[model samples]
Target: MIVDDEQPAIELLEKYVSMLPNLEVVATSYSAIEASEILKKESVDLLFLDIQMPLLTGLDFLKNSKNLPKVILTTAYREYAIEGYDLDIVDYLLKPISFERFFKAVQRYYQNSDRKNIISESVPERNHIYVNVNKKNHKVNFDSILYIESLKDYIRIHTSTKSLVVRMNIGSILQELPGSQFVRVHRSYIVSKNKITAYTSTDIEIGTIEIPIGQTYKEIVEDLCRS
Candidate 1:
């Protein structure tokens, strides 16, 4: 989902795709109108949208779209930073985007994504989940998990015996775990309720290990304690 009017800009983004092995480009468009058409046909998890384009600007397109995915704005101009953040965009990458900067922006997406999911609090629960890695899926029992950690577009499920990294987001993974058994305590962490032996305003204890509760998630920690 790279929507830039310039061919070279799009090519640069495509070139970086190899670095993100799990990334899949469903469609690429040179204009907001074309991108809108593609969105109607496919479900995109993330979008790298350009601000300057013909007909409809990237910001205008996003404002009109009913269902928006996690967006990272790629532009040469820096004037739109405040407006971009106001729309809750993942990150704002200045043009001629560097790999290091790109990866950092992506990491920010992972963090904000987990935070958004926790606030939504509508993920359906399940008792078990499948962890797919390198084309094979492994069934994992929820009760065995100590916690789940965010890995950008991936999630690392840490259990009593072993830790497995799957090419999936924590938001989607959280839905697969029983809500009663798992709790998203931080933007980067989801702790198993069964594994927590102690907790405070800022952190939760799972055995001897402690997981920090995100500042934005203070209400969650407080509400859970009251319940």
Candidate 2:
């Protein structure tokens, strides 16, 4: 079963699932509410759930539901890896999800389901990240990012010399970034820690650009102050 609010995402996932000979897509839901209701009467083996949704989130729904199946979380956010793993999910996939990454996630799920002896890691290594824009993959170096800004349903990856606007959320792209270099200062902003020239309780200055710090991200600011 696949549960995502975006119809395009659902279609893309369905296309991918069809390629797997051993896998079959049972159902697809656009809302978590619909998925939750379906679960009450359906016996699903695996689930591809989205994180951000109206009314209820995928994480909360999974926690509240009974007889939960093997879940591979498909979301636009990467920050939820620790929390999702704490709930014992099979995998956490970031949005604009590539075929390679998607395949690897499913393979991990299959290995775990069959009780294979293999060590699994939640996040993958990256010296560069490939962003899908205009149906093309743009490769950006890890060291080039100044900051990331969320623009409604899109995100702008501001590099040292250029910027790439991807149809993805800020939370989703943060996964591909080098955590040591990048830090989430606000809900809509993520800055390259190394590029930060100045900062205060409310905002940070990266070169000439000023990015605000969210109220909930005060602890992150405190951590930076201590460091």
Q: Rate the local accuracy (lDDT) of all candidates.
A: 0.78, 0.79
What stretches of model 2 exceed 4 Å from their correct place?
115-227
Kindly list the per-residue Cα lDDT of model 1 for residues 1-227, writing each as its tens digit. 99999999999988875577556788899999999889899898889999999999999988888887899899997666546654657677778898766665665566545544322212233457778888999989888899999887778989999999998766556535555577677767888877878889888888898889988667767777676
Off by over 4 Å in 1: 114-227
lDDT of 2 by residue, 1-227 (tens): 99999999999999987876667888889888999888887878889999998899999998888788999898877667546754667777888898767776776677557555343333455679888989999999988889889897789999998999998767567655555567777778888888889888888898788888888777767687579
Backbone clashes, each candidate: 0, 3
